[model samples]
Target: MRTRPAGDEEGAGSSTPPAPPVSLLRSGRALLEHIGPYRWRIVLGGLLGLAGAAAAVGQPLAARALIQDLGRHDAVAGALTLLSGLVLLGAVLKALSQYVLAHAAESVVLNARSRLTTRLIRLKVRELERTEPGDLLSRVTSDTTLLRQVTTQSVVSAVTGVLTLIGVVVMMATLDPVLLWTTLAVVVLVGAVISGVLPRISRATAHAQAAVGAMGALLERTLGAIRTVKASGAEERETARVRRAAEDAWHRGVQAAKWQAVMGTAAGLSVQLSFLSVLGVGGARVASGAIEVSTLVAFLLFLFYLMEPVSQLIQAATQFHIGAAAVARLREVELLETDDAPPRPTRTRRRSPAGRPATVVFDKVVFRYRPELPDVHRGVDFEAPGGMTALVGPSGTGKSTVFALLERFYEPTSGRVLVDGRDILTLPLPELRASIGYIEQDAPALSGTLRDNLLLAAPEATEEDVHDVLVRTRLDAFVHALPAGLDTPVGHRGTRLSGGERQRVAIARALLRKPRLLLLDEATSQLDATNELALRDVVVEVARETTVLVIAHRLSTVAMADRIVVMDSGRVRATGTHEELLARDALYRKLAATQLLLPTPEGFTKAEASQG
Candidate 1:
């Protein structure tokens, strides 16, 4: 089996992986890629905003002319008209820009959700085993929502804000160079303080998002097993656990909010301080006859106007930091591996054409779930040829692992598994899986109508074929009794159905596929004796035309197998008919006798027999 190096074994108890380094440049690039398709819309919005800023910029100049005309007792009608027009024009342009940006932002979110959802569904099974489903769901919903604001509005706002700030600075310089220098000094000092605060906002937001994901995962876990929790009387404990996660999220969110508030305060303070410094200096200059009254008024107006761009810049920065944290999470999901399998074929059929059943062979196969874990299968070797072959072993002896390997839910660490004289690894995944029908140990049913679950594997199966399989699995009567028949809804995980009913549904679904190889992992474990016997006859009938491999513990099921493979500690201990193995294999005999499949020997006590 595969093994991990000794150096990598340290700190195996850590509950979470180390956080990745946060890179603003990398995050920005990823955001740009997501925004690529909507670039033109964002550009149009930015242009409109620039136009609005231009109109606002001209208003102060018009007001200065109007004031000069009034002082000289000249006609001010023309100047007043110009000022009014600029105000209305600026308002209209800004409104149009905001609408366009909002639309583009929503589109960005939709595209992101679509791409992330596709990646999530196609992720390798091994990755899903290690990741929490609830956390993945949060990434798809909450995380992608962050991209809507940051991708378009924030990007365009930053560009327009910077250009507007520069234009306003130039206008202020024209009024008085000394006043402009005073304003610049104050802005520079506050800008430095805000720079230190942005990184903290990013870090805090990252922590808050992670806490939210953890909370979601915890909530999903509790709700998924609410019945079990209620049975165990652990409602209080689970509630406390989820509440702690929520509190952690709240604390981290508060930290992010604290830093954002600091940045906003600094941006506002810089503009206010610049205003005070310019007003005092310009009033003294006017007193010294260094500048006109109209000049001073216009300069003050420009200083006030500086606040708009300053606020925009700060808002853009804050949104970028928050969105970057989300981008990082989304990127981590994109980096996960996916199965390299062909797309599933669209055709459907009731059964494979009549032919010799497919044979299976496990040639010294070795396997494990992970590198750090011990091998679950140690050189397991077995063969099943065109008939019903049952695998019997004590619990945890790698019985279920064999079925998982056959389905390629996992890959063997070593050795080869062959189907019909060809290595399974050489076959396309879709083709390999399409040829086999498997019933899991739990026989899970999805949340949907009974018809939906029955048609999941064979969506195009005809009604006649469905009715035939349902009768064979002894589910026709039960399904008919339901108020809606096949249209009846099964609650989440088939909670609406009894355990026996779910198992029979699973069996019927598999039978509808008409697979060349059928794998039953405790297929009838939940069935009543009468139903079990009936399904056993169905399996015997199906095995005549196709291969059937089963992992069973009940003695009646094993006694009917054409061949039996007895396993012990991941190795095949014996393989033969049930009677031959019972006479030779100690483990098989013990298992058989435990179920009272054999008569009691002369010296065996009742207690020993019960404990066997």
Candidate 2:
């Protein structure tokens, strides 16, 4: 799939041409703009950097003066003292500057990570489905760290290097213009070589980071399905897959290192060649009596000063290349438009009138997961009016999609989803979600204390509220049996609990929300016959006071629903009580028969009747 530039914000369904790849320079500049809030701190750090540079330049001049006054015994001690003080002060100032810059770098990384995490949480569910967790994680963590180097150390070093280079040149010119010109010629040639290779270095680094992200993606995929991998006896194969990814990353890293080493060599060569040229020419001038011997010595010292900055400049450039590559990845995340934008301000909580269940209506709803995909719901029209309704269908008939549309997780192609006559699209997302409780087929749970997961939907729920839901869901006994009760830790994805217990816990969580409408998708699929019967009774009791919509394959779970909406291929084929459907709908009859619920002369067989 082609992607547009980082700044591009075209609609997902738009027909615009794909944009050209973004340049590293552009990404680097975008990262620089993110540093705006820390401008003052950066400026303070830069000032400290300049002060250190000033000290460096002063030290060379002090050393030159001390060397020139060697014959004057009385002046020697004073010169020595001045030179020693300049060296000591420069060291102290350099240390102070580095400390401040390091602090600023850490702060930028912290802030960048916080912002990325918040944005990641608020991204559109569809966008997130298309993105890998590990790639997103790399951008959040590794990329932000690279940005820190660019913001503090790289920028400061570049500026300081330029300043020092300029100061050294001015001093060199005073000693001898001819030698200075000769030195700059060699430096300029080396710089031309560097400029030619710098862009390639960035490209190599970008490739290297991409490799690392790929490795992370592989690791995440394997670990998330580790049980499956081991169960299939494919651990060795999976290990080989991860090894391949790691090897790719290592190769890319070596390629980047190769380019960086070339840059380092060029930098060192420039300084060394300039030194030799200056020394040879300065020596000839001194021999011809055109310049003083002491001046020649000072000029060579100044040449070494020039060498330091040249080395610093190249090092800073190398860092910029690496950082620019990381910024490209980071911008890929930062540029995407989030689902939550123009954040809603806090307002008084709105409550539904008491004694009324929410009415859900689908008015000719048509939807597909993607524009290019077949429709999941084609002009589908249905309503669940303030009571217990069960949606029954064959697999892939869009039974669960009905709930998804009601929740507005994805927009219908051309239709309306209304909650109590208000279009869900018109409702504030938070309020809309708050009014409805959803439990998915898998019933995922976070790794935390049982109480933490229970209170997630309703933090302000009282002890009585928690106790009531536990008893209602028949989970009270389970919780009480635990060693730590409410504080007992649920292992990752609730591995510590049986599947049936996890389902009950999910139900209890949804109950605490006090929602006007509750959606239960395959809620009892994992339960034993006894527990299923118990939960079915609980569902019936809850539906008396609120609306309940259940998507289920088990005929027993929905045989007594107030209404059964029989669906086929994304359309509602029939709706009525179970007996009516059994008599009138062939699909319902076949489904019931498949479950061995054959009709007797009076009604269903005794065993099937008992099952229902």
For this target, which candidate reaches the highest lDDT against the unseen true structure?
A: 1
Per-residue lDDT value at 67 in model 1: 99
Q: lDDT for model 2, on a 0 to 1 scale?
A: 0.80
Model 1 lowest lDDT segment of ten: 1-10
**Alpha-carbon TM-score of each model against the true structure:** 0.92, 0.91
Across 247-288, the per-residue lDDT of candidate 1 in tens digits comes to: 877887898999989998898899889888988998899999
Residue 397 accuracy (lDDT) in model 1: 75
lDDT of 1: 0.86
Q: State the C-alpha lDDT per candidate.
A: 0.86, 0.80
Question: How far out, in Å, is residue 508 in model 1?
Answer: 2.1
